[model samples]
Target: MKIRSLAAPFRSSSRNNVLFLSTVFLFMAYATDAQHSAKGDMATEQKIHALISEMTLPEKVSLLHGNSKFNVSGIKRLGIPEWALSDGPHGVRAEVNRHDWAYAGWTNDFATCFPPGTALAATWNPALAYKQGLVLGEEARFRKKDILLGPGVNIIRSPLCGRNFEYISEDPLLVSKMAVAYIKALQSKDVAASVKHWLANNQEEHRDSIDVTMSERALREIYLPAFKASVMEGGAYTVMAAYNRFRGEWCSENNYLNREILRKEFGFKGVLMTDWSAAHTTVKAALTGLDLEMGTDKKDYNEWYFADPLIKAVEEGKVPMSVVDEKVANVLRVMFNTKIFDEKRREQGRMNTPEHQQAAYNAAAEAAVLLQNNGNLLPLHFDKIQSIAVIGDNATRKHCSGGLSSEVKALYEITPLQALQQKFGARVKINYARGYEKQSTFREGNNSGQSGSLNVNWKLIDEAVAVARESDVVLIFGGLNHDFDTESADKQNMDLPYGQEILIQEVAKANPKTVVVIIAGSPVQLAGIVHRVPAIVWSWFGGMEAGNAVVDVLSGKINPSGKLPFTLPVSLAQSPAHALGNFPGSDLKVNYEEDILVGYRWFDTKKIQPQFPFGYGLSYTNFSISQFSTDKTGYGKNETIQAKFTIRNTGSVYGAEVVQLYVSDPLCSVLRPEKELKAFQKIFLKPGETKTVEMPVKVADLAFYDESKKAWNTEAGDYILQLGNSSRTIFQKVKISVK
Candidate 1:
C-alpha cells in the first residue's frame, strides 16, 4: 500500500473558521499518535496490547508469518502498515528491491556500498564500525526498509568456512563490541538492526542438518556473548535464528535458546524469525519464542510451516491464544517505534553520496594491515620510479561486492588499475598485465553448466613476469574471490587457490622488489616463497573506494593502522579445529573440540608459533611502549585493575599504534590460554611524540567458565597484565595478585 497522504486545509477568510481548522489539525495529530510526548513509548506499549485485544485469531496468525517475501502482514482496519526488511550488514542488497526473490532493477533501490564486516573488524576500531552502520542505515532508510537482516555475529572459528568473509572476528569480546556499535548506529537511524544466526553457525557445510555439539562453557565463553550484547546492550529489535540444530532441536524452535536465554535472560522484547524454512515443527515453534517465520518458501511465500499449522494448533487447544498475541504484539511494537505511520514520507535515497563514499574510503584505508615490510619498501615514492608494473586478475575485476546475500549491485566500483592510473597520470608510467585467472564457481558465476567460466592461462602469467622484469618495482594483486568465498560449502584449503602461489613465486623472481598485496577475507597460507618477498600486506574485500584506499596507503597519503583480528596459522593442520580432527564431521556433526581455545588462543596455549600472530600489523613509522605499571598489585575479585603505559612514535613519520592489553593467568583451576586479549586502543601520534594510555581491566574479564557450576569463576591467584601491540610482541608486564 502507498503511504497515507493528507489533504490541505481550506483557505477560509474568516478568523473563526481558521481557528476551527487549526483545532481540527490538532485533533488529527493526537488521533494518529503523531505528536508523541516523553511518555509516548509507554502509551505505545498500551496501544500494542489494545490492538492485540481487538484482532481476530486468524489476523494474529497472519502477522506472525510473512505477508510477502520481505514483509509482515498488517491490519488495514486498524491502519497498521506492513514493515519492509532488507538484507544487510555491509550494504543494502540488490535483492531486497523485488517483491519476490528476483531482482527488480529499481533505480530507487540503488545504495551506497560499504566495506565488508571482516574488513571493518580488521581495523580494530569500533568507531569505524559505527560509521559503517550509520552510512549503511541511511541508505536502508532511503529504500523504505524498516529492518536490516544483518550484522552476522558468528565467530570465524575456521578460515576455511566459506562464509567467514561475512563474520567479524574470532574473539567474542571484539565481536560483541563491534556488533553493539553497529546496532546502535543502525537503530538510531530508525532502521531496526537484526543480529543474526543466534547460536553456533560456524560452518556452512551441513548447515541445515548438522548437529553442533559443544560444552556449555564454550557456548557461554565464545558463541553467546555477542548475541547477548546485541539484545541487552545494543537494543537490536530483531534476531534471526540459525539453520543448524543446537542440541537435538532446530535453533528456530529450541526452547532453551529462544525462551530461557534470549527472551527471559537477555530481555529481547523484539521479533525472533527463523532462517528460511528452518522451522521443523509448529508445536515447538509456537510454544517457544519463535515470533515470525520468513522465507521458508521464498518463491511461494504464501505457504509457511508455521502459518496454517499454527492456526489449527491454536484452535485444537495445543497452542494458546496468548502465545499468538505475543508474537503479533512484538511485531507491532517494532512498527510503532520505527515511525511507519508518520504523516510525512521520506524521500528516496540516492547512491554514492559524498559522506557515504568518504566513510567507505576511510574504512578500507585503515583496514589494510601491513604484515611485513623488511626494507621499509612501502610508502613508495612515485618520483624515484620511472615505470611501475601492476599484475593480477584482481586488478581488472570488481571487488566491491561478494559473499552470498551480502553481494551488492554497487553504484560504482574503482578498480586498482583505474586508481593507480588516476594517481600517476603521466609523471610515472604504469603497466598492467592479466597475471592469472581466478576461477569463479557456478554459484559465484563459473566453471560449469551453471555459468561456464574456465581458463587457466599460464601465458598470462608469463606476460606478467616479463612486465615485472622491465619495471623498477612491482605490485601483485592476488587472493580469494567470490568463487572461493561464498555460502554453501567450505573452501578446500587455505592456500591461495588455483596456482596463484606459483604465479607469485615467478613474479617475485622476475622483480626482487615485489610487494604482494593480498586481497583475502581470512588468513592465507604464505609459506614456501612468501618470505622471499620484500613487503606483504593483506587487504580484505574492500567496497566502493577500495582502489583509492589502496593507492592512498601506497603513495604515503594515508598510514596503515589496521591489525589482524584473527591469528594466521602456518597451515590448515596447525589450526585448532583441524588439528583436533573435529572440523567437517563425517556424520553431520561439528564438534567444538577446541573448547574455547580458538585462533590466537589455540596457538598461544600450545606454544606453537604462527605465520603472523593476532593483533600483528606494521605502520609506516615506528613506535615504542614503556613505563608499564598497574595502580595496585593486589585486588579483590569484585574490584577492577587499571593498567597504565606510555607509547611514543619514535620515528620520522606520523603513525598510529594499537595498544593491546592481555590477561595472563599463571595458575588456574583449568587450562587457559597463555594470554587473552582483554582490551585494545588505537591512538595516533606525531613523530617523536609520547602519550599515556590507560585501559581499565574489569575483574570479570579474568574469570574462567567453571563448567561444573555453570558459572564464571575468578580464582585467587597471581595474574599478569601484559601490554603489547600484538599477541607475540609483548612490550611490558605488571603482575597483580587477585584475591
Candidate 2:
C-alpha cells in the first residue's frame, strides 16, 4: 500500500510498437483538431460525443479491429490510447515480451498465482472471493492493465471439462454469488472485470467450433444466471463471448444471447469482446452486438473480421454509420472508466507483496474440503507422530503452469513435501516419494519446460509402500494434474489416472492409517476406495501458498469448512446429464437434455444417490441445527420470506459451517428441479456457541424462466423451504404459499 512516482511511459514497444508508425499518419490526418480532452472531464455522455466527433470513419473503424492479438486500435487523434489485455483468469497473465503471443521472461511479469475458481467456489464463502479479487485487482492495476478477463463462472455442466478448474461451480446460485464478489472487488480498483466464455462453454474440446444446441429454458435457468448476476448485480462492464456456438449462432454474434439476453434483459453497460479467433463475419458480428473484435487470427493481426470490412460496409450504406458509432463509443467509455486515458499514474509495484501471499493462503485453506474422516484420524498430533510419509504425483507438480492459456509464471510455489518439512521442522520425520507418473506428461510440474512431452515414467510405488509401513500414517497426495484436467482435451473418464489409485490401495494396505489427499479440480470416482481409506481430503489445485495451507489444515491450525461445489456421483452414469443423454454429444453437437435439473438437482430429482452430495463437506468437529422457523407462511411476487435457523457447535472445537437454503416447488405448471438453491451464508462459531442465522428468499427468484411465454414467471402454490448443510441433509422444513 505504498505509492511512488515514475514517468508515464508509452506501452512497452515489444508487442505493438509497430503502431508507432501509424501514429505519424494519425498526426498528419487531423493535426489541427488533435488535442487531449479537458483534464478531469469525468468522461460523461457529452465528452464521449465530443471525442467521437474528432474521429474520421477510418479511424473509428480502426478502433474496432484487432491491432494486436489482445487489443483494438486506439485513435491518437482523439487522444485515446490502446487498451492492453492479459489472459488466463486465476491471475494477471505474465506480461508478453514479444509481439507474438509469448511470455516476456521478465522478472516483473511473475505474478502471485491465487487459487482457481473451483477452489474459491468450494469455500462456499463470497467474502473469500472478494479478498481474492481485491488482491488480483491490485496486482492488475500495478501491471497497468485496463481489463482482467477473469473469474470464469461457467457451470460445471461436465466434470470432464478440461477447463473446469477455471470455472467456479455446477450450480447457478453458487457460481453467481462467487462471480459477483470477484467482479465487484476487481472493478472497485477501476479495472474492468470481463467474465468469459459467456454461454454453453462448459467443455473445452472442439470449443471454438462445436455448436451447443440447448433449450432457451436451460439457457435462462442454469447457464445464463451467473452471467446475468455478474452484469445486472455485480456491475461488470466487460464480457468475453464464448468460443462455442449456441443454438445456430456463435455466442460472439448470437443476437439473442449478446443483445437480447445480456444487453436488453440484463442491462449490461459495457463492451463485448470475442474469444480469440472466434468471430467469422462483419455483418453478423456487427449487427448482433459484437462491440470489439479481437484475436480474429491468433498468429497475425492482418486478417481482421471487423476493421476494413466494417469500414467498407459503412461507406457503402450496407451497414449504418450509427452501428459503427455505438461500438466506438462503448470502447472509449471503457477506456475512460479504466483510467487508460488518464495522465497521472495511479500506483505501481503491488505485485508479489506479503498481502497478496496471505490472501492466497487464506483462500486456499478455506477451500480444502475434508471429504471423509473415518475413526477421527485427522488433526494429526505433532508430538505423537514421530515419522510421516508423503507420496503422490502431485507432491512435486506445479499446478499454476498447467494446460490452460492462463498459465501462471508464479514467483514462488511451495510443494507438499516442502510445506510438510517446514511445518514439522526438526520435531518430526518426513519421507517423500513420487508414487506414480506418466512418460508423456504435459502438466507443468512433471516436465522441465512449459507444455510438451517429457520422458517421465511411473516409479517408486514399492518404495512409497515401504515408507508408508515405516511411518505412523501415510499421507498419499494423488489425483489429476493438468494432463488429466486441462484445456484442448476433455478427460476420457473420471477415474484417477497415472495408477495413483493402485498406489493409494497399496499404501493403505501397508499402513492402516492412510490419509488420501486428492489434488484435483473436480471429483475422481472415489466410491470404491473411499471406504477403505482412513481419511480423505479433496485439496484443489491451490495457489502459490498451497503447501502451507494444506499443512495448516492437517495440523489443526485451521478447520476445514470447504464444501462440494458439485455432486460426486457414485458413477459417471448416475449423473442426470449423462443418464438423460446429450452430454459429451456426438456429431459436433451437444445438447443440454437435462434442462434445469443440473448437479444436485439431478440427483435429488432422479432419486439417485451420489457418493458425496453438493454442499457436503466435513469439519473437524460436529454441529447441530435447532430452532428452525419462518417469518410467515404466505408471500407475494415482490415479497421476501425470512427464515431463521440456529446452528450450534456441538463438538469441542471451533469451526465454520455453510447453511444451505433450498426452495422446492411441490406443484408447478412446468417441470422443475426437486429444489433450487436460493441463498446461503457461511458463519463461524466457537465450541458450544449457538447462532441463529436468518436467510431471505426473494419471491421473484422463485419464478422459473417460462420458455413458452419467454419470461421468468411465478405460480401461486405452496412452496416448501428447507434448511440443511448438504443438499440432501434437510434439518428443518416450512411451507409457504406464493400468492
Candidate 3:
C-alpha cells in the first residue's frame, strides 16, 4: 500500500475492509523485499570490513578526529575522501575558517534558508519536513559536504532552553515522526543526516559541565524515543553527542547512553561524534562508543584527545587495538553508506534553486499559528482598508544571519515590512515604525550587552501610537530576537524584552484593529497584550521568504494551519520545570523533577489553564469532527486499535486540520498524565467536504515505563481515546479495553 495515498477518504466500511486486505498483501510483499535488502546490507558490511583491514593504526586514529574545523582526515593514497560536515538544523551554514570560527568569506556559499525546527514542528506535516530535507540534502551535496549536522531532536524540556529553537518539540512522538521523515529524505541524496544531542542536553546554562540526573523511566519514555526512531527508522548515518553530562558523566564518554542504549538497544551502526569540546577523557570516550572526536578547541590537531592521546593510550596498552579497529569500522561504514568512495555514483546537488526556495516558502507559510482572532480582524481586505501601520523592530530585522551555528547565508531575506510593501505597494499605503531597539549583540558563543532591560523609550512608543491612530489597521511585529533565542545562553524570563509589553499595550490602545504578529522561536509572555489585541499571530523565525508567507496568511491567500509544538504557559512559574523550582539547577547539577510530565502533560494533569495549549492553531475556515468510533471494544496486548472518524469542512473555504489522537489510562495503578498523544493525521478539505480518517494505535504503545521493574507495563484496564484538534479541545471520546 502507498503511504501517501492513506490520506484519501474511505467513504464506506466496505472500502475500509478492502484497504485492510490490501495492507495484508502489501506486508507479504514487503517481507520478501526486506529479505533481499538484508542480503545486500551484509555484502556492504563485508566491504566496509575489508576497507578497515587495509588502514594503518595511525591512519585509523586520524579518521576518528577532526583535522580541521569541519573536516575529518582522509588517506589520499587509499582513495578515501575526507568527510565534510556543515552546521545545520535549518539550512547549510556559511563556510567558516579551516581552524577558527571566522567566515571564509566565500561568495558562492549562499544557501536557501528554511524555517527553523520549531516552525517546521508547528506545521505538523511530515511531508513538508521531507520536502525541506530534500532541499537541505541537495544543497549539502552541492557544497561537497558528506554530513549535514542537523535535525536536532532534543525534547523541549523548558521554554527557556537556549537551543529550543533548534529542537522539534516537547512530545517524543511528534519529534520522532517529523525527524524520521527529514532524515530519510536527507540521506536519500547520499548526504548523511546527523541526529544530535544524544542524551538530555536540554538547557544551555553550564551545558558543557552540567550533570543531569533523571529517573530511568524519564530516560526511556521521554528522551530516548526520538533518538531511537532516528537511528532505527530514519537510518541516520551519524549521531552528535551533546555537550552536557548525563548522570555525572560527559555524554561523549557516557557508556550507558552511548554503548548500551544507542549502540546496543537501538542497534545503531553509525559513527558517534562529539558536540565540539565535549570530550572529557581519551580512554573513556574511545571505549564508550565514540567513533569520532570533532572540534576540541586545540590549536595542535595532534594534541586533541582522540589524536595523540588515543594513539598513546593504545600503544601503552591502556586502550586496546581492537577498540581502535572498531572505531575505524564505524567511520568506514558511514563512508560506504554515503558512497564517498564512489564519487561518480553520489548526487551532484543544486544550490539556491527555485524548488529549494519554494520548499522554504511552503514551510514558512504553513507555520504561522493564529493564536487568537478575537474580533476576526485578520484577512485584511484591501477594499475595506487603505492604509496599514506596521510597528516593532522585528518587522524589518532579518533572522537568517543570527542564531550562531544554525545561521545561514541566505541569498535574500525579505522582512515583514519588505513583503508587505512589495505585495500591496501599488494599491495600499503602508506606514512603519520601529517601536523598540535591540539592546544586545550576539557573537559565536558569546552574548554582549543586556537584553533583559525593561526600559521603554517613550519617544518611539509615541511615534508607533501616532502611526496606529492614523492607519485603518495596525500590525505590530514584536517578539524576541536572536539575542534571546540563540545558542549558549538561555533567556532569563518569559517577558518580552526591549519594553515590548508596554509598546504593544500602547499601540493596541491607539487602534482596536491591532493584530500582534510575534516572530519568535520559543514561547514568550503574551499576557500583557493578549486581552488588548483583536488578533494574535505566532509567526516563528521564518526563513528567506518569511515576509511573503506571513503576508499570504494575513491576506487569506493561505489559511493558517501551524500549531504550537510546546504549551504556552500563562506564566513561567506554571511550567513543570519552573513550577517545581528546578530549572538550570544549582552547582552545575540539575534534576528532572517533572519526569514524564512535560508540556501539555503537566498542564492537563494539573488542570492548569495555559495561555495556549499544545497542538493548537486557528484557520480562517472551520471544521467539525463527527462519527468517531473504534473497530473493537476489546483488544489484546498485540492488537492494534484502528480508530475511524469523519471530519467535515463546514466553513466556506479550503483548509487543513491536524486531528490529534490522545490516549489516557484513567484507572492505572500508578500516577499517569490525563492524556498522551499517540497518533495524528493532517487532512485537507474544501468547503462542505467530508472525509473518513483512520488512525491506528498499537496496544503495546499504551504501556507506561515501570521504573521499579525496569520495563514498560500496560496494565490490563480500560483506556480512552480522545479525538481533537488540540489537547484542550476534545471533540469525541471512545472507550476500549486492553487485556
Best by lDDT: 3
Question: Pairs clashing in candidate 1?
Answer: 277-296, 447-453
Q: Give the Å error, residue 545, model 3.
A: 0.6
lDDT of 3 by residue, 515-545 (tens): 9999999989898888988899999999999
Give lDDT tens digits, candidate 2, residues 436-536. Answer: 76534554322222232222233578888889989987888877777766766676667777666777778888898999888888767887688789899
Compared with the true structure, the alpha-carbon lDDT of candidate 2 equals: 0.82
Model 3, position 543, has a per-residue lDDT of 97
Best by TM-score: 3
Clashes of each: 2, 4, 0
TM-score to true structure, per model: 0.92, 0.91, 0.96
Question: Of the pair 1 and 3, which is ahead by lDDT?
Answer: 3
lDDT of 1 by residue, 1-739 (tens): 0111222343435545656666787788787775466469778889889988888887888888776768777788988877788787788987543355668767766567777888888888889889888887788877778899889999999878877878888988889888999999888778888888988889877888988988888888889989998899999999999999888788998999999999998988999988766777788888988998987754554457667788889999999988988888788888776767774644244455899989989899999999888888997899899989998888767865666678887888887788999888578888898788765553532223112133446898899999999998998888878776776667767877667777888998989999888887876898855687989888887888888898888888899999998888899998999999988776987879999898899999899999999889999999999999989899998888888889999988888998999999999988888888898899999999999988998987799889888788999989998889998999898899988
Where's the lowest-lDDT run of ten residues in candidate 1?
A: 1-10
lDDT at position 459, candidate 2: 51
- C-alpha lDDT of residue 613 in model 3: 98
